[model samples]
Target: MVSSKIIDRELFERILEKKNSLDKARPLSAEIVQKLRQEMEIEWTYNSNAIEGNSLSYEETRRVVERGLTIGGKSLREHFEAINHVNAIRFIEKLVEKKQKITEQTILEIHSLIVKGIDGVREKGQYRSGTVFIGGAVFTPPPPIELKARMLDLIDFVNKNPDKLHVIELAAISHHKLVWIHPFVDGNGRTARILMNLLLMKKGFPPTVILNVDRQKYYRRLKEADRGKSKPFVDFVARNVERNLDLYLKAIKTGKDEQYISLQEATRHCDYSQEYLSLQARNGKLEAHKLGRNWFTTKKAIQAYLKKHATKNQKLKFIQ
Candidate 1:
């Protein structure tokens, strides 16, 4: 076993301290950052019943994301099922469209959904319905009398913490402590992951989804964290952050300055574009870049450049 000394918890804390700083990132990492976002969406958009290998292709997955963006309107479980569709187009659409609020009740609602479809989920939202064992030890939840208070204390801690801790650390601890408290009867694992991302997204880090491909490693890291080993889990999370950063960067970099398609530019490049890429970029993406003018990319860039220089009376004809 690698010695605990090799992975100092403080190292992780230092990283967390740094990441929480705004503008800590550079434009050079656009590609990687976008991929991370895509991967995270893929990971969270899973069905409890489906074989782990099942997934939507890139195009089909975006729609599911669109659904996730609007997930706030419905019951927790219904929203989860809607987002977990095996379609990339749907997933990305949801992700790009909406942002959900985080709160104690939101956590509970999600907890309810994660356990709802699982086998032996009869206990559903209640505290432990099935036997649980940890480290060859019989497991017992906090006394029923204490369960609600413990949960309340946790939510209070999350909301009232001083010094502005990194949301990821807050999230990791939420996973650890929630399991320790084992507040609900079921859905602990799934709910924990969802809450982790809720915290992540709340912190502007985007979602950090643990892919089925990384499930074994993820579990092992969690085990280490539970055993009073914090840095390994931090490393696991940092790696994910790094991965997500890669994804975001990718989405931003692929197009040349000219290809910077706005939502309005959609119709010209793709077969079905509800959104378009326009020269006058109005989204946060361009504002974040501190550019002189809103513009699309590559081919679209040329059109905008031409339109800007066009004679007032001349109508511009361009390729679709």
Candidate 2:
């Protein structure tokens, strides 16, 4: 697993910086921010599930989030059902079961089980992914024997420094380190992203999804971090987190003020049909506040969706 010396004083500082939400916040009016939050939450789930190969179109995906389940497919569907939720499960488990302590074993166990369904193709229970990138250059991994010890050391560092530094920063570090190790044979990218989310969730922050659409920007950020730079990776993670918060805050703001937007309104702002929007809200799958009989969602959710899932082979769009 991980070594004792990795979580030294310096690593702790980076964690602190990442977790102090207020320190780097750009600050926005409560009204604007809340709307963004509501929108991002709804949209991120849809897009993240899609890239995981969920195969649901915009409306169909919304309907599934609302009421349908693709249980017939490989376990991928079930896993996709809560592709965004495993982080929440990990958070509660850590706090309630492990009492806020992290160890190399804890990290491995979390990863092994969470991605279990993707085994053969992705080494569901594996690590490193046997994939390597020499500063943005993808290359075949070196023999596993050569890097196993370093990978173990990284794990040890993570467990040792559990609470001193911010989890987010550690997450960013682990993500880069794991990729560098190329420990597993597949699923490194997805696994790394989930590990990052686990870090945020450990600290009571919402898990962030780096959408496939943003793959270029996301890889660029990772490449920057591999250069042994801090801000670019931290900034990249911060942006993803803030994007999530913007959606949550938007929904929360309107949710607090009882501000309301309707399905037609949201879809118009988006491009989905009123029926599609209603199915989403009616089933309580999306973030929307109801006014009498009508409900409306913030624009962030809609934009993120349009950005990620609109394609030629749309999934079924009917409301369940």
Candidate 3:
């Protein structure tokens, strides 16, 4: 069971607030939903593959999945990776639509779509038959002999939610544990991420993309979890969830001030300089997320931060 200390309550509540906002704005027009779904699918495919060292540029990935065109300088495997991932996303979406219960077979099917035409036929959806080690990962996976039991335990953990974990907590912990189990000889990272999103989507939350730019931080947090310091990893996952919720709200134009602005622009309402705000954003201190190379935060998020940190004697400076 994850300790209460593992997740930041403020961050967790912020995600719920934003998720509720998106929900309240629900039944979006088909055209808008379709457009947002398409944009997310491409971004999700690009980032998930990029984290695994796929060299396909975002546009190259878009072409491979959308146009089915072969990229000139990329390997067939890389192109296949892009295609396979989008297929995997669709598989999960269907499962969500049907409200399917996640089971061992369900996981296997997800992994199968991820590695199809890439891994050998026998290994495509199958657990490793021998021991394996993840490069640069702090912990070794359970041996092949323990794989089946470990996986069944994971499935039960997710289904039962014995600790009554929040959906996001359950998803993040399950993700870390799956990667820890190292169920497959390959594609475990991608599979874990997809499975995590499956859990999120099941709860009516949007699919969260862990950006490729945060790849190093992602691995570092996972390593921290392996070392029994789980908070950083869980918080890391929570931050991404909040970011996507913000994105969804922005796409739907849910509120007048819900849009994210560059940190430089955000400084107009607060005493912090752009550099300081960017630093806070990177540290997860301010409610901000990255757009490409720069950090973006909402005016509302800045006001919340100010209110939280201001002394009682100091009147809160509202962002008007």
Best by TM-score: 3
lDDT, candidate 1, 197-296, per-residue tens: 6566665665665666676676677677767776677667666765655444434554454323433453453332323234233443222221112223
Q: Give the Å shift of residue 93 in candidate 2.
A: 6.0
Better of 1 and 2 by TM-score: 2
Give me the displacement of residue 319 in model 1, in angstroms.
10
TM-score sort, best first: 3, 2, 1
Error of 3 at 10 (Å): 1.8
**Model 3 Cα displacement at 109 (Å)?**
0.5
lDDT to native, each model:
0.51, 0.54, 0.85
Top of the candidates by lDDT: 3
Candidate 3 lDDT, 38-122, residue by residue in tens: 7789899999999999999888888888889999989889998999999999999999999999999999999999888884546
Query: Candidate 2 overall Cα lDDT vs. reference?
Result: 0.54
The per-prediction CA RMSD against the true structure, in angstroms, equals 10.9, 11.7, 8.8
Answer with 2 or 3, whichever has the higher lDDT.
3
C-alpha lDDT of candidate 3 relative to the true structure: 0.85
